[model samples]
Target: MNTTTAATEANVTVATIRDWARRGIIAATKAAGRWVIDTASLAHRIAIGAMKRPAKPARKATFSVETMLAIGGSRWQKNGMDRVYINNWANFLPLEIDQYKTGNISWAAWEGQEIANRQALLLLGSIDKVWFDSADGELHGRFGSGESRIATRQEVWETVVAGIRTAIAAL
Candidate 1:
């Protein structure tokens, strides 16, 4: 079969297959201006590798609720809000989050800030579109500018406290 099909069957890159063939680990032939590999030879090499090095035993992933709590607490301290891992089952969330931030802070710090943003959203009694930033770096609550708004000073404290509790429970 052609290199592309062979690579697909082998679960490796075309470059990897090329490297293996160049190393004389597998045989290949030219077909239609492209390299075609012998499926049987490729299978034998894979079987040999399986017998020699073998595949490492797969392990189950464990999610620690403590880690979630720690993340929430850390965010609360930094952002003056609450945050939770909406869905980071594989722990790749930090990398995913870095795509949105200034890329200077640690993943833990960034995660906390994100949680706090969500907390701040609810606390300020603002709609989903509103964002709040503290002027003095102390007090933070939302204030919507447009006609489509749901922010007010009177209910801000209670809503934020309730939102924090809800966010914590979501973890």
Candidate 2:
């Protein structure tokens, strides 16, 4: 199969097929100066991907303000994230929020007024998309660098709570 067909069949980009060909990850040969991937090999690759998916729903998820702040670290207390993750839970959210109405001051303004130099980790940069797996109680994502990375759940939770503390103090 040609690179275009192989990519579609494998549910990946054409560029990925080309890279696999160049790296000998799949069996391929030049035809009309283009890659002709082996269908059987592509099928094997697809099987491997299926085995790696998370058991949970795998829906798109964003970090909460506390989670993002925790990822930013000590600096978050002074300078909120340079750009809020998920457009930031705090950006337009009211300062004094309740079930009935939102306060006049926004959290984004609050952070800017309180701190500076706010750019840092809200999630692993290597991973382009992130999701939470409630069943396993873990975060799952594929790194852009073409490999899997692992971090302890404990560390994630600690930072999550720390961020909440920062927000409470800002209040």
Best by TM-score: 2
Give me the displacement of residue 99 in model 1, in angstroms. 35
lDDT of 2 at 23: 97
Candidate 1 has which clashing residue pairs, if any? 75-112, 82-115, 83-115, 123-160
Question: How accurate locally is residue 129 in candidate 2, as Cα lDDT from 0 to 100?
Answer: 36
Q: Report how far residue 130 has shifted in candidate 1, in Å.
A: 34
How large an RMSD does model 2 have?
20.1
Candidate 1, residues 108-161: lDDT per residue as tens digits? 111122233333333322322212222332223334432212334334434444
Which portions of model 2 miss their true places by more than 4 Å? 55-171
Q: Could you tell me the TM-score of candidate 1? A: 0.32
Per-candidate local distance difference test: 0.41, 0.42
Error of 2 at 53 (Å): 2.9
Clashing residue pairs for model 2: 78-115, 82-118
Per-residue accuracy of model 2 over 1-171 as CA lDDT, tens digit each: 766577657755454676798899898986533466888898998888789974444334343444444433221222432322322322111111112144322111111122111111222222343333333434343343322122233343343333334343423
